[model samples]
Target: MQQGSSAHAIVVLARGRARVERSLLSSDVLPLGYRGAGDMAGESALVGMESYTENVIAMEDCDVVRVPTSTATALLRDDPALMQALVSTVLQRQAEAEERLTSLLFRPVEGRVVEFLLQAMSRWGVPDARGTVISAPITHLEIAKAIGSTRETVTVTLGVLRREGLLATAGRKLIVVDRDALAMRK
Candidate 1:
């Protein structure tokens, strides 16, 4: 869903992955984070917002359940447990966003790139004989947006990692060839 659009429904992602982003006035889109199974979007609608505050874009094929705002609001009002769960979800996501923003502000671009790669690997990595392969086909531009850097910077950083034998490219994905060697590395 596009940012600033009227919130019609809260989308529950039942399967697959999606990217969450926010747009700046300069027409730049910044990646907020990724969402996968059991995650949700348009949650502001349930809390009585006029429009969604962020964009949620599917990165691959997905199965989503759309719950109308009215229905979700009513359900939240009626079910204490569900309300509690929603509250927890909101808080957790907020905390993660805070951490991400903080990292962008303080960490060097290369460190951010490595951290992002490691996080992606942990999230979607499949064990390979060579190393841990990230299953998703994440582009450099997407990684750049996520880590608050230019695509060129991310590409160079990845190349550096590969040269150091810490990372490897496999088709559209990447592999973490030496996890320990990359720890807190510059």
Candidate 2:
């Protein structure tokens, strides 16, 4: 959906990938995070907000379930445990956003890209004979947006990592060849 548009319901991703991004005045968008299967978006609706704080665009074909605001409110009202879980989720997301802001403020682009890759691996990577493989064919532009850098920078950093034998690619997937070495970079 468009940024700043009112959301009447929470869209839960049942499958596939989507990016949550914020538009800057310059017309550039910074990706806040990626939501895969089972992740929820438009959470502001649950709290009675009129609009979504970020724009959510599907990165691939996805299946989603829409829970209307009224239904979500009713569910929270009736179930204390659910409400507590929702509160916990919100707090966790807030903490993550804070950490991202800190990284953007202090870290170099290379460091940010490495950190983003590591986080992606932790969240979605599957162990293989080669290394930890992130199955998604994430584009350089997507990486750039996530790390607050340019696509050219991401491409160069990735090229450097590849030449250093710290990362590899097999078909569409990305493999971290040397996780320890990658992590050692500040």
| Tens digits of lDDT, candidate 2, 18-89 | 888889899887777889998889998877789888899998899999999999899989999989988998
Q: Which pairs in model 1 have colliding backbones?
A: none
lDDT of each: 0.89, 0.88
Alpha-carbon error at 185 in model 1, in Å? 1.9
Per-residue lDDT tens digits for candidate 1, residues 1-186, read: 878899889999999999988888998887778888988888988767889989998999999999999899899999999999999988988898888888889999988988898889888989999899999879999999888889999999999999989998889889999888876573
> What value does the lDDT take at residue 114 in candidate 2?
93
Ten contiguous residues minimizing lDDT sum, candidate 1? 177-186
Give me the runs in candidate 2 sitting further than 4 Å from their true place.
Answer: none
Q: What is the TM-score of each predicted model, taking all chains together? A: 0.92, 0.93
> Which candidate ranks first by lDDT, i.e. highest?
1
